[model samples]
Target: MPSTIRRRVPNALLDGSRPTAPSHIDGSATRRMAIVLVTLLGLTHSNPAVAQIEGFTEPHATIDLAATENGVVASILVKEGETVSKGQLLATLDTDVLETTLEVARAQMHSTGKIDAAQADWRSWQSKLDKLRELRTKGHASQTELERAEADCAIAKARLEMAREDQAISALDYKRIEAQLERRRIRSPIDGIVLKVFKDAGEAILPTSPNVLTLVELDPLRARFSVPTPQAASLRPGSSVLVRFPETGRQAIGAVEFVSPVTDAKSGTVPVAVVLPNEHGKYRSGVRCVLEVPPPAGAGGSTSENSANRATAPQKTDGPPGPNRKDNHV
Candidate 1:
């Protein structure tokens, strides 16, 4: 039978160069066994699933629809989980005041009669001057009186021109006021679902306070998460991604939309993102889940992982190359 020496305690010297050799095992022989044991432990942790790589699942981003101006929130036009379109009305500020101001501006424009009658008076004065000059030069009127009439006609023409210009300026001012008033009716900037309505009707929503609503893209929803540095480097935008939420029973397939260029030292990770199509408005933000991102091609020198349906770890994702990358799976 082969001799078995299982657990031998270290002797006087740590390198196993004992002051005296053990009666059964030599000092050199004891050290070699210890080295072999340590090697086995090291190999276990080096496996891909055991350590050295991982990715996390999280929301891509949360967009707050803030109040741009202060006013009583007239109404929340969208309910929770309601799908909305870009530029669709999402909330309304009590624009009663803004509307009133706009009306005043309109009224002011209407009251300015300067432009309405200005050209008519100028033509009338020109006709009178023509008749007067013809008669005066024919010796029908005094030279001093003709000069006075000419000067009067010129002044009238100048006053009419000045009045018309002022009226044009007022009209422009009223149009600007109307545009400002339109701002009070809040609108959505993206085609997304209304995640929340922060205010109810008759609530005083302020510009500095939290916004009146929260929205996130729906058709092309984003799923965000983080990954360790080593794993992140292998990921590139536009790689295929698979997502699942067992609790919600939501499984979405998309592509890697974004990967942060740098890692965050504090978190010891880099952000990754994916964009999933949610035309039915069934998925939502803030849900815990798993995002399976496919590894990039040619990364790790094009290993056999591409053909393997079951990977040792999460699949790597290719990030989108486009500049408007709204779909990263971070």
Candidate 2:
């Protein structure tokens, strides 16, 4: 302190210009910052706290009912919006010709006069052949007469067999006609409500015709969600999920029915379906809904984490809810 030591200062420092940092030091600091940013990004994506997912409600099944055979519609038993049960007759095609054919086949099948006559003829010929054999053994009948009797018996037996075969064929024809008549009558394949009727009575149905009706099952409504891959991983079939319909201001608990194993590569999402009870027909399908997804295992304080991340996590929609799409139903 007593003696002042002179120290050399750089020109840049003396001129109020700070010295530049070393290239190595700058590089090291940049690398450390890059690593920290990478780590933070990874943590955010790997353990994301997803609370609610947006989805839509849809029917469990949609069916387009059509006739298997081409014919004119004779009668329509159900109206639009009518509830129907499985195997209930919904409509009938023109069956006048088929009915007549079925009656003719039935009469033919039941007719036993030809068979009875053939059996009588066979018995008479067989008896005659036996008598002829005895007469031939006693040298009372000619060999030609015995041979003719045997041939007649064989012919009669063949005729009887032919009559029986004809009877069997007639029975088969009757059954075939009955099946044709049944096909003309349309029946419901499932217990559901008829959404629409495309055909009317006396309308012609051809191979290229439109469907007869549109049916849907709504008892167990299906709610579908496109969830983030991370959230989907924690979901399993039969897990309870809370579903809220924003339009109706109603909420209900549903059971998870399906979770797709494959992920949508473009959206990084997985498909999930839940079954919501709608036995009373209270909830209509095609409504927007929200689904609550629980956090993955080992996620500490998931409640607070989900709350904190709720605003940052935006709900994703793969597309417009897929309502009324038959292939989209669970």
Task: Compute each candidate's TM-score over C-alphas.
Answer: 0.63, 0.74
How far out, in Å, is residue 227 in model 1? 3.1
Tens-digit per-residue lDDT, 200-266, candidate 2:
9989998898488889988778998888787788888976565667676565556789999999888
RMSD from true fold, candidate 1 = 17.8
Lowest summed lDDT over 10 consecutive residues: which window, candidate 2? Answer: 311-320
Q: How many residue pairs clash in model 1?
A: 27
Model 1 ranges off by over 4 Å = 1-61, 107-113, 136-147, 207-210, 242-253, 264-269, 282-284, 288-330
Per-residue lDDT value at 253 in model 1? 44
Candidate number of the best TM-score: 2
Please give the distance, in angstroms, between residue 133's alpha carbon in candidate 2 and its true position after superposition. 1.8
